[model samples]
Target: MKKNLIMSFVLSTLLVTVLSGCGAASKSTTGTADDTKAPAATTTTKSEKSTTLRIGYQKYGTVNFLKANGELDKALKEKGITIQWTEFPGGPQLLEAMNVGSIDVGHTGEAPPIFAQAAGTPLVYLGHEPASPASEAILIPEKSEIKSVAELKGKKVALNKGSNVHYLLVKQLEKAGLKYEDIQVVFLPPADARAAFEKGSVDAWVIWDPFFSAAETSAKAKILADGKDTVANHEFYLATRNYAENNKETVKIVLDQLAKVDTWSKDHPKELAETLSPQLGIDVPSLERAAKRRAYGIQPIDDALINEQQKIADTFFKLGLIPKEIKVKDAVLPATK
Candidate 1:
């Protein structure tokens, strides 16, 4: 009877041990099932549709008109794409945002992208606005002695560095039979440059519209030389390489709308000024003068435009404005469809 009891106890212990082992295995399987479900939930969250199209733009360009019109939103809404506009003070800042991947598309003057490219920012030229040569100019106070670009020798010339106007000043100086070193170049953005010009701290202010128009009307400034006889200040629409390559269709939509707006602006200067004045905080007449001066021709990128851009890059590099040589063609997108 004692031996039978010992065998029974041993069997009971075996059963308990096996059951404990099976319990642990079951718990392990349950944990794995939980882990598998968690991944699926995460995947679903990540797979949710991304539907925002972010565009970077300056206050002075066609993108501003696009934002004000709301037509781009209407056009893209059907495709599950919504427009998000970011305003930048200038092209360099706009491209800076693009370089950091904060913006998908932007518009800038001819020089900003070159500077951005020299700094290793990956960009592609998507389209361009026809050169509005008269829109940008070198201005002198109405009563100042500086009559011509040649008279600017040894004078304080205020302008924004790395801006399209920078190249304009350089070319204007060369055209006036003066070298860059012959003048005192004071680098300032539009606001500060305008301030300095008003204060008479700078001899001449190199600027663009509606600032140019405002200066002419408000400050009684005279144009020493406009872009007419200088560099072609072709405004460029730019996109990140990744965005341009992946979203050609969306880009095409934007280009089409911009083309329409450009044409409309050309035909209706007073209307464009009326639409822009309240937003720009400038008077209607100044805005009207600016609108009329603008060419309002946005075109697709081509080899000719690329070559012209290369000249700008080369000029900046030669002048030691950009750190290194950059090829503009490296960033040219497939011809706008």
Candidate 2:
């Protein structure tokens, strides 16, 4: 009877062990516990995107307008990226901040990047806006006798050095048969330039809109000559090489956002002006004029465009404006299809 009981107990224990093993196998097949944890970890890794994209912009840039509208911020937020916007009074100052790692991506007129690159900044040209030559010009106070670009020779000319207007001044001087040495170039930011222009200390101010338009509306500044037949005045989107290399998709997204803004602004000039007026602190009329003159489209930097930029760089180097001769192509970030 004792032998019979021992055999019966062993059989019952084997049955329980078998049932537990089957339960564990069923759980594994349905992805419970240990089996379920891996996919969850992978899903989290794929979705938990995180990074900050710092964009540096000048006061009147369209990118700033884009930021104010929150299009870029909204678009980037979905990809687990946040945008940090920093405003600068001028492109040169913006790029100066960039050189010290304070900025990741930014936009500037064609010249600022050239200056920044020549100064050993790791600037990467991502894209460019269509040429907006009519958006910038050499202005004189309406009451001033300086009527043409040629007449300003031997007078004090105010402009931001290493700016788009700087190139305009150079070319305008060449066209007017005046040497750069003939005019006393007063390097000043937009506000100070406006002040000097108003104070009658600076005879002519070379500037870009909406400052260009504001000067005309509020200060009665007259255009000596616009860039229509001179410089291309292409606005450039730039970044550090490091940023462009790591965040390629983010760069593409920024350009895509810019294109959308360009399309909308081109269609709704009045609305664009009204929206930007408060941000720029200029009147709607002035902002409208400025908006109307801007060429609203974004283009990738191509060989021809690179060649154009190279000409600007070479010109600066020849004139002893930039400290060293540099190739614009060296700063360009090649597009990966």
lDDT scores in order: 0.79, 0.81
**Per-residue CA lDDT of candidate 2, range 1-337, in tens?**
9999999999999998754442121111111112311011011122333277767777666796787688888888898787666666778877776676666788999899889999999888988889999999999988888777888878999999899999999999999999999999999988899999999998999999889999999998889999988999999999888778877788889999999888888878789888977866789999888888899788888999999999999999999999999988888766721
Model 1 residue runs over 4 Å out of place are: 1-50
The Cα error of candidate 2 at residue 198, in Å, is: 0.5
TM-score of structure candidate 2: 0.84
Q: How far is candidate 2 from the true structure (C-alpha RMSD, Å)?
A: 20.4
Q: Please name the candidate that would achieve the greatest lDDT relative to the true structure.
A: 2
- In candidate 1, what are the lDDT values of residues 1-337, reduced to their tens digit? 9999999999999987854442121111111122111010011122233356667766567887887677888899988797666666677767766666666788888888999999887788888998889989999999997668888889999987777888899898888899899999998878889999999999999888888999998889998889996788888888887777777788888999998888887888889888988767888889888888887777888888888888888888888889999878888865652
| Candidate 1 C-alpha error for residue 194, in Å | 0.9
Q: What would the TM-scores of all predictions be? A: 0.83, 0.84
The Cα RMSD in angstroms, rounded to one decimal, for candidate 1 relative to the true structure is 18.0
